[model samples]
Target chain A: MPKTAFQRVFPYLLVLPTFVFVALFTLYPVTRTVTDSLYKPARRAADPSVFVFLENYADLFDSTHYLGARFVQILGNTFAFTLATVVFSVPLAFLFALLLNRQLRGTGFLRFAIFYPALLPLIGAASIWAFFYSDTIGLFNTILRGFGLTGVNWLGDPNVVLYAIVLLNIWKQSSYCMIFYLAGLQNIPRDIYEAAQLDGAGWFYQLRYMTVPLLRRTTLFVVLITVTYSFQTVEQLQVLNQGNPADRGNLLLYFIFQSIGERRNWGYVNAMTVVLVLLLLAFTLTNFLLFERRDDDKA
Target chain B: MLQRSLRMLCLLLVASLLAVTPFVQAQAQVVVDFYYPTAVDGPITQTIQEYATKFEAMHPNIKINPVYTGSYTQTRDTIRTELAAQDVIVDVAVMLATDLTSFVEEETIVPAQQFIDRMENGEAFVANFFEAFLANCRDEEGTIWSVPFQRSTPILYYNADLFRAEGVEVPRNVNELIEVAQKLHTPERAGLLMPVAGGFPIWLYQSFAAGFGQPLIEADPAKVYFNSDASLAAVEFLTKLGMPTSEGGFGVGPMGGSVWGDTPTAFTSGQAAMIYHTTGSLTNILRNATFEVGVAFLPSGLPNENGEGYAAPTGGGNLYIFAATEPEVQEAAWLWVEFLASDEVQSDWGARTGYVAATRGAWEIDPLKTLVEEKPQYLVARNQLAHAYKEFDSYRSIDVQLIINNALSSIISGNVPLSQAKATLDAAQAQIDSLLAEYR
Candidate 1:
């Protein structure tokens, strides 16, 4: 079939801007990071960078001193943080969505209240939380003392710091995921629930068999977004912990930040970035596969 | 046709005038980009801009572009990023004085000696600054690479009201500090707060090491005494302060460590009876505290053979001109540096911002002198300069600092057993040794 020349040219023009942007930002940086990971950066600008091949990667895992020993801990912290965020936030968000979906008194007010934490900037939220988490004069300790209970060192104790940060993340993130779940809830026709009610299905039974399955797509989407968001947690760490209290709260991203800012080891930092990128890619691929399998089952 | 051609000639003449004026202006103008960080509170950006405006007014041909970079750490990072990108946008900057070694190693900065030598009263100009403030500006060979600007040292800030009510004298030595702190300790208020928490405990910890008779870094940037006996005593003293009494500790402050930013607030609010904080916080503390505030030198636990028990590490920023700049631009930048470090400006800055003026001349000047007469807290930091040492700095400093800081935080937080504290330091020393292996 003969196509008009303008039609073909117009399509290329339409794609050009996006392609150029992706090439400049995403593709270029990723390629540069990969190349940088393979070489040892020069100590000084005048010195030439040495090609170290996979030595940077080996250094990351093999060397026990320096950042190597902490790498495992940081990797564990990253996974734990992401898992906890996803696990707690998804369920809490689902509960909020279900409650908000109900026709009840003060639903509008409740919706606003739940979403308030999400509205605050991460740094601002971290600052407020720092005040709340202060050991001597913080709001949390004061309240605990009022109840004749001993105060907890929320941000300072190595044991409790990660969970303290997790709580902040859950507080900020659950509401965000709830918005997605709310839209998902809206998309589900209410008549199906009514039909289930007519069949004498208990609330729990319907929730398990009906509401849960219906929201699978939304849950998967929310989980994917939340997981990626969890992996990129740096600002809160910067403001609240700075990978401190014995690096208990140090996550992968903050570790990368320290590597660059403190050590100026671009090669090591790039290697860390490469590992992080691979981790995210694997998670995304797994999610995609899950989604594809579900579609196949339906087909 | 003749009239049209005449009009065109006039237009061409006007266009040429407009084009040539900027070129002439460019020929006469040398623009210097001055980057500074505001580590303390108040209208710092405005104050810096005001100084730049005053300087520009005096030298109309040289334009001063004053950029308020976020914090000292941020300013260093920004400069490093620019250097790595080969942009070198900053002509002169107020970077951490401890960054001198790093800058020298990278060959990114021109030594201030070159410019000072060119000055008529260069020797006196260098001598005008307090010796402690100049400690961080020189390398092993004693080449001056920076000019001291916003210099400070840690001092003990105590609640005078609490000390008076308790009927106790101010602690002058480490042993007395422990005794006084323990006596003032209560369930509600901590006796002492040392703001040596998180990633950078080495600054305040240096005072402890120096008091114990072993400084962390000397002029030799290749070496540090992280595992020295004096270093061990310093850490032990610091650890005992925060440890519970049952655990063979002084049980004074929080178990891990008090935060840097919260230290002044704690003292001012009476949550802490005493705190080790930067002299930069003096004005802020005086402004906020309802009770009388007393400033004293940091008491090193043991007295030196000279019978001096006080020790502190000097900190804060120094003005550095980068090497990448044009010679004329570097000269212009040096002029801006001198203008900022001038006695008049230094005195005004010290009085306004609570930073101890780098030069003794600034101390003898009007505003600072009068402020000292009225409050007298400002003089304590300057008086303590006699006991101050160079801050911990070396080749690969940030990396070495991280190792030491992590170890100290772990030890202080009780993650490392007191029995194993020495072992932890040894491991840190090993890491630092490897890090500085290239230099050696």
Candidate 2:
């Protein structure tokens, strides 16, 4: 089969504008961020933009102050938060999807209930959760007090604020993940389940073997999306705790925000942005490698 | 069919071109968009818009748009980014005093005093402003980069009911304040309150430093004197008052409120026995409180000392004209600023919002004078202006405040010892010094 030159060029031409736009808006800024990471903080407003190669990176490793330690602490917080969110959210989403896939009454309404939180704007959900986390006047603490238990400062305590944020993140994002799982469940062959049932398999066995094996791709997709989304989850941190209670809940992105927005140290902020991009890239690569090995083993 | 399709395409192209043409055209009127941070409360945005409307009405030639940017720090960043991108120039901004130093250093704003001097109302304008107000508005080189708009200094706000209930005298000095706070503090009830959030703690600390006869920062403005003996003593004193019982100080607790909205509520609700806040909170108190409120000078450093009985830092908002604005737009802005400073407007603005007028003539107005006389707190703010000092001039003042506030919070929350807190503050100061040196 011979392809015409025009036919091959037509597709590339059609996508050329989009490619250019992405290059200008996304790739250029990212490259500039990486370049800026090599420079030191500009000494004076009048000083020429001199490149201080690797100085900013060196400062990140210095132990005189807690900047380096703080960076690691925030990174750990982000990883812990994201891991906990995925662990809770992925399983719950699968459960909801499985329940919704069943031939039951009000399944349509149940699907709607499962997907409702996905429709909420992130900051609006964060705001509502912030009110619930409020110490003096909050529903959660009030319930705790009613049970004759001492109220915990949900967002104020350094020990618990990360978990509180993770709780909020899971609450907002699980419904979204459930939608994907539900769609995946619908795509699975009904004949497989029916054959499993006829083979003396119960619902649990069917779900454990046939359904779970068939949903591996979907599960991989969900994990990748949720992990990336977690890295970029700035709104909840911004609106709820604002990385407060002594910056204990600060994520990498939130630290970047504080550096650029609050401190106006764009150079250092750009350096932090470079670090974040590398971190996310590493996570993505690890996910791909792990999933690819699993696929190979199954084959 | 081809002719009909061509006609349809022509019509679509014309519609699209019409939609794009206005964006290409240079607007007829000089539209000056001003981004202003709300200095006090929320509704003040409406008041600022009203002022913008009046300015627009007076000068139909120039359209003035006032955007309610968030906090002062937010406004600074927004303006800086806008300028860096060479986007729509923020023709004017209401910047904080602490922010003006950085903006001036960055060459983001024009010197308003020179611009004012170049204007027709130059001499009259220079004559009208208060000396202290004018001094605080100037840059390091004495160039006035902003005009004082809404100004305030910290004043003592006491609960009259609590004073009567505890049978304690009002504190006129720091020693007396400590004594009275000790006597008045009741656990699970009311105690003394100082806001350690945002810029409030810096104001309190700077005021205390000034009262202790200590310089806040060095003359170069690149160094901090925070770790000095007097400053450390002041921090120790403040930490002692705010520290919880577990930390070996009076167990006074932190109170929550928007600077303008919550302090009055805390006092009137009897959740706080005494509040150290700006007199700007006076209007909220007058409007909302049913409790009898007593106003007094901020407690002085020590008795029989050269330090004044009360010292206040210049706390206020300043209006800055952008360097990139057109001359005509600057003229329109000058006219509006002058109008705002006029006796009638200043008095009205003072009467409406609890801000003290930037000019002395605002106090001379009979109605404004009577209002101040009726509410002595307004008079206290006005009288405190003489003792008021400008906040520290440094690019890192806000960051320093955040560190100090967090350190103070740790002390107050019983998470850290006062000695450890002081050491942490000194380390924080050292970090700031390094930042200053790096920037320098």
Candidate 3:
């Protein structure tokens, strides 16, 4: 049962380049971002890189920028955006995958149409939606005018804009999730469904039990990716609203971006980045370790 | 058949693009990565490539690789990211004039003054630039960090045909503007459209501030005078224009929906009679507008006791040379900047691109003069230059801008009270003061 030393070393050597690549890009950035939060520019330090820990984090939390309106609102917005997107996109994608899984005429064409939004550059898609939301000459307004109703400012009004982007984020991500679900559906053997039918289980019951449990792994993967995508919601926010109506659409990553690009507060930005990374890591781990493991424990 | 042809064409296009670059970059000793933004809406990237080609022919020793970065904001981010990642990259970049302070703080760009000093007629070359255009490009120490390249100003573009039909003259002041708007407003058409979007709200707001004879930011970039009596009157007056007639104000309504880009379309499509936008959009307006477009200075606030026109803000990008190991590279960047600024080049560039020439002398040049005759709108923008001052910029410029932008967005939405607007300014001033505290 003794393994040759070369066999063990060979596996490590084969994976060495990939490990280095991941470490350099992924692990290194995470560590650097964490360390960078500890540094602040000091007048006495000629280099402008002094290690003043936690100052950046403190400055960000205290209502610094928007008079008395702190980042508490922004974090709330990010959470709302993430939860709304994951909730709508995962179920909707599953619905789409179920619909398309049928051997029906025009299924191929329907799939293409459903997935079209995902193919366009997200910023460009945001622009198209902005035009639709535009008051004077937008499609929605034009339709509203035809209906004798006043037009809604979808991207400008604070109350409506968040939902506007939520609607858009769902549109953008549903198709992306659908592909994974479609693959998962395909992987589920047809005989399993046939056996369910033979057992007198209805389609609804089959879907709730056989199909849902079978696709747990796919749903987990989709949720993980979608949650990550939701946090990094910059492109559409910039295009449609630029995080406007008093930062109503301002998500966490967008705030981090503005901190770096707008404020040049490197230490503060890194602190926010570190916070976001930790939150995301915790989210990912909880999904996989807790909810994701429940099925295995049951098995 | 169509799909097959499209695929073939795509393959050929890709092949040709791959084939051409190696041949061009091969013979040059030094290749400059020149990144620029498409500030003006046009075939600007193609124009840049043509200019680069000419520069390459003139300087056989140097090859220029022009990268068309998307927008001014994107270009700034691209340079910042590239510099942060690569340390020393992008030999030269065209960035927002207001970005000089941040770029200097980041150490991504060197004082272009050094590059100017090493050139032939370098001193004269630096002096030839208009000082107003240089306002945002210099630090507090008066160090010139960038060369004015593509510059523009905010102005009022009116629907001349609509004005003629309504028998309305171009409004000279805020009171008169509302009077004219009263005559022009229809159930179907808005009397005016101006941008209050998060993108360039501050630029257009400057035109209003100047009307009240106050600059938003004092010459000292650190000091902001936003809550002054004049500023309150100016913004409240603007708010009144968009306030519904039912609200004891003009019926234009908050127009919170009309973004800067949408403003131009509103005027062009004849949905709105007047619009406030950048002169950078003049050519695009002219090309697309069906009606005869009239160009005029933004409506001034109550003229000062001396009766001066409302001040406009100079806006656009300037070229900055980042420090690199090779002196030759910096030298090449200097030459390129000079070429871009030269009267012969800028005069034609201004005319073709609708950007104002950076140098006063360029206005006298034949290319610009001839274009002025062809399109009098060019002269109107140039004439406004005298009233135009530098854009309000300061250290931590982006942070200050975002604070102001959010405030403007809030005010224009009509939900926030004017007092909230004042409070927003107060908070922004505090934040900006704190941002500069580090430098101290």
CA lDDT of each candidate? 0.88, 0.72, 0.79
Give RMSD to native, each candidate.
2.8, 5.5, 6.7
The DockQ score of candidate 3 comes to 0.33
| Chain B TM-score against the true chain B, candidate 3 | 0.88
Residue B157 accuracy (lDDT) in model 2: 87
TM-score of chain A of each: 0.96, 0.91, 0.91
Each predicted complex: what DockQ?
A: 0.60, 0.19, 0.33
**Residues A1-299, candidate 3, lDDT per residue (tens digit)?**
88899987999999999999999999998898889889875422125577888877776677764422547788889999999999999999999999999999999999999889889899899889988988677899889878888778777677787899899999999989999999999999999889889999998999998899889889989999999999988998887877887788678888777767753467778888887888999998888788757878888
For residues A23-60, write the lDDT of model 2, one tens digit per residue: 99999999988987776544345455568787676766
lDDT of 1 by residue, A1-299 (tens): 88899977998999999999999999999999999999886888678789999988888886455878678888999999999999999999999999999999999999999988888899999999989988878899999989988778787778888999999999999989999999988998989889989999999999899889888989999999999999999989888878887788799988998878653588889999999999999999999997968789989
Residue B29 lDDT in model 2? 71
Top candidate, metric lDDT: 1
Ranking by DockQ: 1, 3, 2
lDDT: worst 10-residue window of model 2 chain B: B253-262
Native contacts recovered by model 2: 0.05
TM-score of 2: 0.85
Question: Which candidate has the top score in DockQ?
Answer: 1
Ranking by TM-score: 1, 3, 2
lDDT of 1 at A108: 97
- Tell me the lDDT of model 2 at A177: 91
Task: Kindly indicate the candidate among 1 and 3 with the higher TM-score.
Answer: 1
